[model samples]
Target: MSDLLIGGAETSTLAALASPVTVIDSTTSCQDVDELFRADEHLGCLAVHGDGPGRSLGLVSRVPFQHLMSGRLGYGKLLNTRRPVSALTDWSPLVVHAATGVAEVARQVLDRGSSQRFSEVLVADPGAPLRQVSVTDVFRALSGELATKALTDALTGLANRDHFLQRLQQCCTAPDVRRRLALVYVDLDGFKAFNDGHGHGVGDLVLQVVADRLRGCFHPGDLVARLGGDEFAAVVQLPAGVPVGPAARQLGERVRACLSGTISLSSIVLPGRASVGVAVASSVLADGETLLREADLAMYRAKAAGGGRVELVTDVGSTAPREQFAPDRRELQRAVDEGEFLVHYQPIVEVGTGRLASVEALVRWQHPRRGLLAPGAFLGAVADAGFAANLDLHVLEVALAQFSRWQRNLGRAAPRAVNVNVSVQGLLHPRLAPAVLDALSRAGLDPAVLRVELPEAATTTQLDVVRGALGTLRAAGVRLTLDDLGAGASSLHHLTRLTLDGVKIDRRFIAGLLDDERDAAVVVMLLELAHSTGIAVTAEGVETRPQLEALQEMARGRPTFVQGHLISRPVAAEEIALPWSGGLHHLHAHVPGPRSAVPTAPGPVASS
Candidate 1:
């Protein structure tokens, strides 16, 4: 039996199936072991113990061991009854360490060939008792759990971004494929606002509803996936000889119509709309990223051109070259060197007393030809040019200097902290911690006076690297926050691992908080989560009195802060007005209701 077993040395001892094994002492006779196997018909194998307690000498299987002892051969009839069970034990049975990976165990099992494929494997430490595992259990768990996690979105139950890209790649690389493929990038226009207004509980339902609508808009063969947040993508095969442009346009129109109607959850009726961008595979060799980018660019164009519309990448009148939209690399570098960038500060006030708490530092580009442009217009270009870190450092330095100036003027009346947006690139930079500490030192400011805001979307990838850098920043006494929580692919999973000072709820939820039950519930949940963890919570985009009043009510017993136009818009450093400074109090007195007070200009600040 020992000689018949193969690859025993290579099998992982840890890979034993988590199942019960029948154990018998090595002193037990073959006939006794046979009787024990007969008593438990479902038992696949038994462990034969050696002289020491809990020490397994080897394993014996029901089938082969029984055949050897049945006296089928002349030798078996004469000697089987008296032979020790150890004679039938598989001494070289497949053994693996407990720490071995499942994949390696499966590979070793398959390598043993079909004869031992279903045989029980021993999972144990050397000199320890053996535990049995089933090969079928390993494959079933791997195929069921790993496969689902890899291919499906856990939230919406649709194909995930990874699965969608893989299928798109397959379609692009299919040999001699003649049919064209269309990629439609759909972004819900006001989803963030909807989520903010209603709450995450209802927001999740909205996403499911959108997913169902999207799934209905296309044929069963088409692939649809939520690319995080309000973004969704679909890849469909176009009929032979059908022009990509017309097919994409027609499909986008159908999707728009399908998603345009109102969705009713409980007693609340929420309106829905999406901006769709269509890109077709120009050739069978086209890359997935390029195709997706083209579609994304078109989606932006649709959004910029007053949203709720579909735009095709191939549309001559609507589509512009990608380079044209992105700022010139030299121009961006010149802006940094020439001091062409400016920082604007927006006040975050306590919901209870409306007292000034902190001001978030937002960046604006003073583009020579483009006038005073928000970061959105050119920050993407800066990021694409690999200057995101440099730009982030510049903003931080300026914000710290300005914060110092504010402290000089206000003395003890200054806001508690000034928040500067930190890009993921900046956080990961080797010099980030040193640079920040130096800035604070030069300004003679405490690390607690300056809070760094990191976008939630940015921290999802390369977490170890992000966490390492963040850990250094935290160690330096610098305050850190996850900005725009619940806006993109925000998850509570991040909150569990990273050390954070606070979380800023994105304005989208605030926009609907007053009238939306879902928004109210989500806000309360976030406040509870933050408060329970000893992390502060700030709500952004509080543009109305009703929203402000409602947030105040929700945050009655908690330490919550609010920021938006209703408090004050982002203004130049010199224009920052705190409640103690008479600026905030004056504005609050004049604004009677929502949309009643008009600001001189729209807020130019953008999230980092």
Candidate 2:
């Protein structure tokens, strides 16, 4: 909050005051001067000069510069940390002409320092063009009142969101800020659960505990801030000699153990834990935002990997990256434009009969560079960035068209049934049934021949939407299958309310069905429930001989179905083949028009 000063008559204040400066166009190398600053034992300061002859642009301090050089800034440690001294000098030593009042100079100082990485202000006289007028050092000139008002978080007495953002931006924009940085985004696990179980009083206590734990984790030079609610962020400049990764790992582990460990209050133990997403940017990250994103993503990964554990933020270039959700949205549009996405089909065969009852339509990405990637590689990206609905619609259209062709070839008696897995959006969308019915009618395909599958875990809070959609689908003769049922709680309510055509037991529950007693018992119970409801059961992920045998035993004297790698893996659309002969098991001919899209390599179905 110090008055941003410039030598000019008047200037508007910048968003942030303390930021690093990089000379995008400088004649002198700051490297030699930077080394000098690092080696200095007292009054550590860096004087930056602009590109023009005999011109000083701005100055930087030793502490912030040290933070940048040591990799303690934003994602500074992950990617390239150093920039040409010329770049630093080009923007540094900001010049403001004299005749500028203290208020005007303050505003200019604020505006310039808001983005650049400099803690001090340089005033120049207008009459002398770049001559010095006065110096307003950051810590020395800024009053305590202004500092308190600008930096402190009103709720937690830590750094506020704006201050954190500005500081992080500087670390990201600063030259060599990426040399080393350990950025962490922390969220208290089950904090909401506390509110649900013990009311707001307990929730507030939980927040306080989290705040205290975070405060205890840093040094005097480190920054700890409450971004809001139960979320907090931290930026620590690690010691030059210390390795960034190990130190960060230690801190993350401590955070996990300390937060999750039981806390006793008035003899009532609160089972509190936290999920921390950590990203080391010193060597891999490019900016503060990227660093924060990586940490947030890693934290989510940690939570997904089962909370109370730490995960390193790797897979920078893979689908796991945050940008995975927002890749050139243009690229997605381009993919659709170029028809780079292709439909593949996997047969959903009956277990004992080994006969194909239907095929599951799956999407494959024909990425120009990545070769062929599965939906897992890019579907989440599309879905998360608000494109799933369109993509799902496209898949449905393609699937219906393919089924129409397949049914025509199979003659009048052939089953037109095609199973297409819909995303959560499609399942929950109010227009889903109408959309599917319209596709079926347009294709002249039987609605009964189309089975729609939805992932159980993806269901949203609007259970009624799914119920209504599924009800409409059922009434229209389009079969509905609750996919990945055992992977999550699909709730018997959905099953009973919607009158589903069937349930596809998740691969996880059916995996190794012959051995796991618990999985086997669940499968049996599911089979009984399906039978009582007059619904068919399809066992998914059945791979081994024992698994098939177990399924057969369960289906003995009963009508049940199975789908997995043991029968066939998903394959390209054109590769899908049906037997010419009436007998189910004979594949005696070799026609090259198209191979079955099923996976040729013999691997067990994915562990559910």
Candidate 3:
């Protein structure tokens, strides 16, 4: 085989292709070379040189030398068997420099086609002995690596979507008429909420837990795969005596039970549940795509029926229309146009000095009948309607405009930065950078004053696009932060991959800090990680004085920021008071109407 090709063109160099070689001196005899080959049967070729390693005289391959010596008119009869190997060496063998790329070397070798019996290339470096690289080695490595990656999901180490589909197809077309195959589609309940509220890190932990549970619930022969973000599918082969419908239902129930429990992470215990849909192949000629669609529809039905339940494709009662599971797109579009959305600012303060550092921009819906509604009430609806990006942009524009007003009113007393959440859709948008920059330009605010916070889950789903947008933002002098750091499935790996300015410790961990020693330790470790990486740390949900005191103690003189009702409830743009009086004095005078005073003990706080 020839060197690896990219787009039908060879581009690898001999340096990348080279492997350690067995070297022989110029005076080494044929018998000695034969003995060396005998000791290591895998050794295909040998390098012979004079004086030192840099002086390569020629090359000799095992096959050609053996063939020449074994011929009827062989060198054995004309010369001594112990003669120096130089007598049998090819003085003008193909040789390449160590710096030569694979592409050029492949072109030169492959151009000879099958007529040439070359199996390896000799790579030479200045002042060093030649190294041998077998074409077979490169081909095997590349093929094996590509095949493994193509079949596996990098995050969870499970079979990926493509592999799942292929296996499903095989099951549908298998030649056993009496055998049955079942496809179970599992969608996690409240996963988006968990991801959105917490962070992708915690969300990822949930996914990994769900994957492990799903794998444990199935038979060894079954195939399980993560079909992307909180959704999983499995192919189960029914036993000979088992009925397909009953088997599938049993599988689904077992899966739901296994996954519907609490996932313990560090100091937090997150609830987990899944809605499952099952579809069985009816015939050998069953269509894979149709079966998958049926299973998906059944899953949606299970979700619509309040989730945490199993629904089968053959059950007539499970045939709910898809529309019932999704929010109306037109309604969302109308809301965007009718200006039903509002922006709220929640304060983030320095834990030591209690100075106002920044405020995060949160979106709310001023519903005509529902009064003021938080994002949890309608963000999902907007996302389901494929209007999340628009809503995010709208929120950004409103927040930026309001921030400009605040800047004008308070002058130098304005908060250092105004953070706006960027949804996955918004982050992946081609116009995200331009739209953000445009909003800042229109508001006449410097880019440094507008920080973009992304959920951790978004980082894993569309990594390249998110990284690109973040790069553009960082280049523009805008700050970037990872929100809900311990809320969802987050990894320390993200801190290295992403260009982040800071991390917001999830409120749950902060809420647990007073009572949970583990939580306090986790927070301290997170702070250490962030500060060591040159990233700032903000502890969210500091409602109680105990929590604040705990965080302050943990800070150990480091600058830690805290955000929660203990400081101030999220208020309208006009109500934001800046250059905080270095304490909670402002909270005493400007408490929002009809709301309970901030809780003092370790408990839930008003949502930020």
Candidate 4:
């Protein structure tokens, strides 16, 4: 290990540092292993591996181990001696392979969110026992190789693209931005032409010169980077209290001048110019990629209008590029990690006696800058991002967990079950059934208390997918319902082909069910279809007393449920307990009135 460290951390591979380590049985008691740490002060932690079936690995750090055993006033050593090591093991360690470059491993180790930055790392080598590597050893070698290899541009002596992006995320993510964060994107307008015309030597020199000028353009608090080739970017902090647009433009102009100014290459002067684009975030409600993209788009616009000028984008979301506004899978993944997604519940009540039927779970994205966003704003984007399956599972877990909480509090009074929507992609995901069942098992909740809703006409063409995913769920005593009944596909075909516990009359028909004959006809037909099929019916988007009265009049003694602004809009989990116990309470979310606070850039946004 010392030889590998001395040889050079960058060039050495992780395989070289791999050392055989003892693996503790996961079922071993803490008291039995207490003497292991006391006997060896140098032992940082021990690896614990479970037996067959659900064979999993974990790490028990000396600190947490000792703390747990010590107890208050140190009595836990005797009382908690028999506790299994698996109970206290950290299961989610960042695993790596032996063939991985030490530099890469170090970067992965240190690049995690600070809370998890120092989690355990196990080097898995084929034909060998899983060996553990101390994080302290990784940190010791960080100084020698990390600065030049991972962060700094070797040729230009500036922050590299990765480092620049990290800094930009930091600026955009700051809880309070003081409304002074901005991004500057610089593209050397004719550098490629000049580089191709000249040799590689001249091209390299030009890049170094551009890097130097960029350095001069940004200050001590700013981050400037060579985003590969001729493109460079900066995350700048403007002087507080000044207008962001003006200040950003002023800085952009300086960068333009600095790059286009004096460039004498071996007594031959070259026109070193750049198209500079500036985007200013007036508030903390900004996304790193969105801001960078805004600046990049502005730069392109400047280049299109003829080079060597600065383009500024002041209005963030409205005037910024439209592509960034759309939902992105990567953005959704980040939102899940950052916990920007939250669940809201709307009461579904029986129309006859106003008895609490169930609560449908609605997913909302709570943006740091925007109060809350409905499914209309980003669900399509999530689906487009190909994250529909993952997001659906995440939402299912959240809704199920919330239902468990309610069941804990209200006992019998809690809504009978939680109805959660599952997208078509999620319904097709192989892991859906097992994951849902596992969650229910872990929560000690009955599968009957969880109702998974599938869009009615969504999978008509793919009955195989429907059968494969829904079959296991149905067999487990889980209720399956069809949402937006007449919204898509063939309603009658679905009623006959699919085994549904209930069907939601599409919101479109209910919106004007009383006044529109065609809509009334559609609702009546849907009710007849569901009733004849022995499935319950839910009238969605029921807003007024007239609509409710009209629907109740049409009911032919079948189990009918209604949900919409009429009974109450969706509310937070804690606030939902009221409607559960009260049976017919109209719940509402007190939020600032309707406003489209679309992110100018993608930052923290929605989930399922």
Candidate 5:
């Protein structure tokens, strides 16, 4: 189906097909209705209403109205041209609930009398006027999804073998000519052994984990799919004018890192590893099947070489050298010494007042070679290298100095507090609290004005160690809050053992606010929990007007703060207006694009 008919991904529902329609008075003349239809092609249909509050009388279609207006002769047209349209309207038009499924709506439309089967459907929702949805749109949406199920994996929801092959052929046949095509093929190692040892149920969970990791590691513009069983593939299009060698190598390295980690299952960790192979095809001359075979063979070579690494093959028959992706302790320390890190601030705004309540200082890697990298790209390596503590302290020092500068410049308008995030190593480190206090002291900033955010992973496992740091920071008048509230595996009930000043409701909850009732209930429960404790609540990752409105409604009368792209994206410290002048008039609910409904999984500052 075309975008105009389906509207967007939410097109499965009848409402996505609905174009807003106004209720015209029953006494509106046919002449006026004709003019309205002639003025706008979108006015394919209109609704008629009668009496006070306007109960729906009937619906009028352009074709039928035109037929009625012209009449059989000029005498008939002259007599009825100025008459009210309601007299000729179809009062018994099919009315459908806005929430009805497209397929079901299509079925209902087909069941109607033959004469009216092709007419527009009148979509009804409370407080909204009847909307005209075309019969053709209903069928088109149905066809698109039935075709989708044929090409999608029911387990991982990635494209199935057939779909992947189909798209690969399309890309190769046309050969973008500007972009080279490359495939990243993956095969799970020891999967059969793991299944026999842990049962297929556990094996299935492991496969799901691999699929999710692939999603996290690849760009959305790329295609990642399951080639059945334990094998998956990704088609990555190289940037225009960029050769396939370095581009494929970097992507392979990054993806390899994301896929190498162990899967944490209930009470047991599974050593889920894979052998990855990347094969490149030139833009000018290519064949999808040949590329697939090359990638597959490279993957076999990788598995033979002991698995868990990325190998690349090109048509030129050259293979990139095999190198591991782990960041060493010395290398991490070198990053610190070289001053290759910077900070971006994401503001938390007061709901109704729109005032910037506080700002979260998120760390970014200003890599000389990699441009600005999100924390997700490097924090895991930092953890592996045992340098999370050093990175945490550096970010703290930089955040404090900038915050002190802001206080000096804005005076009373500066934010009330600044929040800094901590990783597992940092949260458990004995020196974290002292370092924070020292940094605040050096910057002449109040400890109370600094908020330390603890990632969920840090507290779920190392509660006792975290408790000690929590005690020191709390006693020093520094605030402490739990970040990414539902992201970890531990029960929230266990968190009672630690002291917390507030919680940042995870982006997952905020993303699903409008579509999922369970998500909404969880958010409400979290809000109520914070309200009862007399602590603050920060709903993070708000991206749309509907989402913001929903959170505002749910957190009503409570001291809640909202943050995300809709308020202001993570920006350099110099970009925020102190006092958030005029309540950030420039930033209110201005979402970026069609995909803003579910924001790109934000890599929170250092989610190590």
Candidate 6:
């Protein structure tokens, strides 16, 4: 017996058997079909038979001709309107031989139903020509199969992080030579605070808000994924030498602006900010680990630069002698783990006035064997240190604690803000906002008084993750500065992108700007840039009269601030006490006394 046709059985056979049998050449158009339908009402379709499916060999139905005659249709669409019958007919159509079991036929149809074509399985005789031998009809068999297969992400509707990662890994390894990879690690700034401040419902909204923003950043081929809580990642192929730096900066700024100010979620205005960290991988990443590490490092840099900023991690080749330097890495990581990271404060003073303006908190590692080490000594060694986050938290806590101590001991609050250096790791750490708020709460200090300094290199467009993180911090009334200005693209790049309160001129230019014309030009440009943007410029590392005088002169024209050794050196937080009485005059009058030890002005001021 021939294969049994199931459900539409008799109807399908009658439709196929009763169909008009007339040969029509491939040249026949829908207009030609209209004539046939006009001539004979019984004609429904004229089967084209030749070398391909388009070859009109016979007529099958009159309905298709009617469609042509009524002007409800044009010529055959499959060919031109015209979807190739071959295109509709899946070439790699699932098939089973005539002897195949019914269960096997069902399985093949089920599997193929999930594919792109979603083609139906057909049973055919192999010994003879490829004549149809249907065990079960197409629609009835495949519909149930389609229901069994699932969409990728079961929960969020969006692809899960794992799926996104696998996709990105494949993209990284794709043969496309121009394929550029950028992973933006976005940590919703103050999301925890939002969650804690409001209920989880509000928190979910915040996450959704971030999800929407990430979605907006997507291009045609870009993929954005939420890496579980608070953190999200994006992979994109960007144009080469396209200055992803600026784009990252713009992304950071946009994310900040989007989340900042009053976020009115049904009158519950969520005032928040975000810090973003971004890593760009052009061509293929060296490997998965390197890709992740670079992205992570970039995020850390963003966090370091006071969040709400962008940081890019350039692939510095594996030039470091890791084998020889392996011991240093272990030891440094150990030191960080053991809480051996030390933070020392350096004072920033008004250049000509010689009054303290701020204290810059610097980090030190008391390596037992190395004696003392600045960041330069072991930055690479501790680049991937596990305790980096801990160290930043400790420093922030200590800085705040020390600031509080200074406030209490002195008769008056220190005449300046305490400038603290924050690392990106600390900024994007899950605990960042909470830790900062906790420290402030414990110290009974106002967040406004502290100035967090971020390095120039870290404040780029590519650090949106850091930006979102910083956005959270900024919402809490924390003051931020883009430190080490004039060092990189950040000087010009950040002024427009970040919502910074001030710019700290890096020491390199400020230390010599007064004497070197070239340095002076750079300083002048910075001063102008800051003033134009309404951001106060603070000149750091001024040690001589001429440098101080130049800075003072520059400030005279443009509203600029100055800090350096010219005013005072780093002192114990206790030493720079202000008088309870009148402000600077009282402190100045008692300056030479035991209460105040103002370093004597050395000789006549030397001109640069």
TM-scores across all candidates? 0.55, 0.48, 0.48, 0.45, 0.50, 0.42
The Cα local distance difference test for each model comes to 0.71, 0.61, 0.70, 0.71, 0.74, 0.54
Candidate 2 displacement at residue 164 in angstroms: 29
Per-residue CA lDDT of model 2 for 102-182, tens digit only, reads: 334433444443344335454443343233322333222222222343355433567766678767756654545545666
TM-score of 2: 0.48
Model 6 RMSD in angstroms: 30.1
Q: What is the lDDT of residue 263 in candidate 2?
A: 70
User: Clashes per prediction?
Assistant: 15, 58, 20, 0, 0, 55
lDDT of 6 at 568: 46
lDDT of 5: 0.74
Please identify which of the two predictions, 3 or 4, would achieve the higher lDDT against the true structure. Answer: 4
Q: Kindly report which residue stretches of model 3 are placed more than 4 angstroms away from their true locations once superposed.
A: 1-325, 369-371, 577-579, 582-608
Per-residue alpha-carbon lDDT of candidate 4 for residues 370-406, written as tens digits (9 for 90 to 100)? 5577775667668878988887877878888888877
Alpha-carbon deviation at 178 in model 5, angstroms: 33
Quote the positional error of residue 47 for candidate 5 in Å.
56
**Ten contiguous residues with the weakest lDDT in model 4:** 1-10
| Number of backbone clashes in candidate 4 | 0
| Residue pairs that clash (backbone atoms under 3 angstroms), model 5 | none
Model 4 residue 539 distance off true place after TM-score fit, in angstroms: 0.6
Report the C-alpha lDDT of model 5 over 73-97, residue by residue, as the tens digit: 7564576767887777887788889
lDDT of 4: 0.71
